[model samples]
Target: MLQYIIKRLLVMVPTLLGVLTITFLVTQFIPGGPVDHMLAQLDGHGARSGADTGESATGGWSYSGRQGIDAAQIEQITALYGFDKPPLTRYWEMLKNYVRFELGDSYYHHQSVASLIQEKLGVTVSLGVWIFFLTYLVSVPLGVAKAVRAGSRFDTVTTLIVLVGYATPGFVLGILLIVLFGGGSFWDIFPLRGLTSDHWHELGWGGKILDYLWHITLPVVASVVSLFAMKTLLTKNMFLEEISRQYVLTARAKGLSERQVLWKHVFRNTLLPLITGFPATFIGAFFTGSLLIETLFSLDGLGLLSYEAINNRDYPVVLGTLYLFTLIGLLIKLLSDIAYLFVDPRIKFTAQES
Candidate 1:
């Protein structure tokens, strides 16, 4: 197991490098980069200053008496943002910094990318934990019941509901939730935005907890809707498959009760897939499908931050976040495989077979 883990960790180096290379290349080639944005700002400033003083500001005066940026000044700006360096050189430097856990400063936010992520991490983590717990807590039991009562009225009704939920997008659900319960047109039960009330600091500990839950209720529900449908269905299918297996039949034939057969024999086998899936689902809680939900609820999280960073052409934040997320994803994949062994101890990972 230790050898397998070490091997996986070793493999991650190239995987991360490849991801960073592609991301860096894309950012470099994309239009409206940091240089262009800076030039546009400078041009706008020059135009306004020229209008006020009837003279070209600073440098890059055109013969036509128009405001412009000279090549020297442009070079200075480019160098300042490290854009003047060759792409490979810059990529090498970035990799070195990343190896040391240095994400550098955000060009737009004027703070280190790591610091910005740290500030936003708590909200995303809170949402992720709630979503993860709620998804499994509800899904597993519901799925088991549905599997046991397949073809019954309860199963039919639940299948319809699950299908409807699975068909609806999470963001769309968030919008519907806001429209219904966000105090504008209909019943106002939940807060429209934010992860906490304005007076959160003033509240007692228990009050703070309740207030946090209150604010997060709608967002969490919206986020979990689609996940619940998928997980519940997956669980139900896995359980049904296990129940039909010969082991379950034999267990029942050995005089075990239906409950014992279900829980002890079938349920234990059904968990292999679910347990292996936990890592991706839990880590994905931090990012997957969170952008619109965070935006709708005005939750400052990594998803919203990444969206803003991309739109604003904030490459440092974009690349930094990408690198971090990619590394985490790769690590989680390794952990998932390791977890598979725990779920089914019969599995083995020999170097030759692997």
Candidate 2:
């Protein structure tokens, strides 16, 4: 097992390099860049700076004059970031920095990408955890029941509801929730923005906990509802398949109770397929939490930070986030592979076979 883990860890190095290379190439293809973005920001303000150099007050310098200023600024930025060097050299430098966990500063935010991520990580992770727990907890049991009572009224009704929930986009659901329960038109039962109230620090620990949960209710619901449908269906199908197998019948024939057959035999194996999909599930959980729900509810999470960075052309933040996510994805996949051995006795990771 240790040898297998070591092998997988070794493989992740090239996988990460490939991901970084592709990301770099894609960023290069995007029109304009941080330089253009910076110039736009300084359009009206550069005039004041120019006055110190005996330039005009309006700083609406002639095209040639503006070109000269832009040239100088670009040179400074390029030298600072080593952009004038060969692409391969820069890529190598980036790899070195990544190895050292030194994500550079954001061009727009004026802070280290690492610091920005640290600030936002907790909010996104908290939301993801709630959604993930509720999704599996509620879905698995409902799925087992649905399969046990397949074709019954309960199963049929739940299937329909699950389908509806699965089909609805999270953003649409978030809007409906806000409008219905966030004071847009109906009862104002939940807070519409942020993960905490402004006076959160003033409250006692219990009060702070309650306030946090209160603020997260709608966002969590919106996220969980979108996730619940597919997982429930998958679990129900897995259980159904297990229950019908010959082994289940043999267990029953051996005088095992229905409950024992289902719990000890069927359910234990049913989890294998689910366990195999954990890597994708983990990646999905992190990405899905922030994009629509966080933005809609005004939660300051990683998704919002990525969105802002992309719009502002903050390459450092964008690339740093992608790099972190890729590393996590690789690790999750590795963990899932290791889990297979424990989840099923038949699976093996021997040096000879693996």
User: How many Å off is the CA of 332 in candidate 2?
Assistant: 1.0
Per-residue lDDT tens digits for candidate 1, residues 189-213, read 9997788999999999999999999
All candidates' TM-scores? 0.90, 0.90
Give the per-residue Cα lDDT of candidate 1 at 175. 83
lDDT of each: 0.84, 0.83
In the range 1-354, model 2's lDDT, one tens digit per residue, is 788889889999999888889988777556656665555445643344445545454222212223535677778876765567887887888889999999999887788999999999988898888877888889989999999999999999999998999889888999998999999999899998788999999999999999999999998888888788888999999999999899999999999998999989999999888887677767777775477787799888999999877766778898899999989989989888888878787887874654
lDDT of 2 at 1: 79
Clashes of 1: 0
Q: List clash counts for every candidate, in order.
A: 0, 0
Candidate 2 lDDT at 247 equals 98
Off-target runs (Cα >4 Å) in candidate 1 are 45-67, 351-354
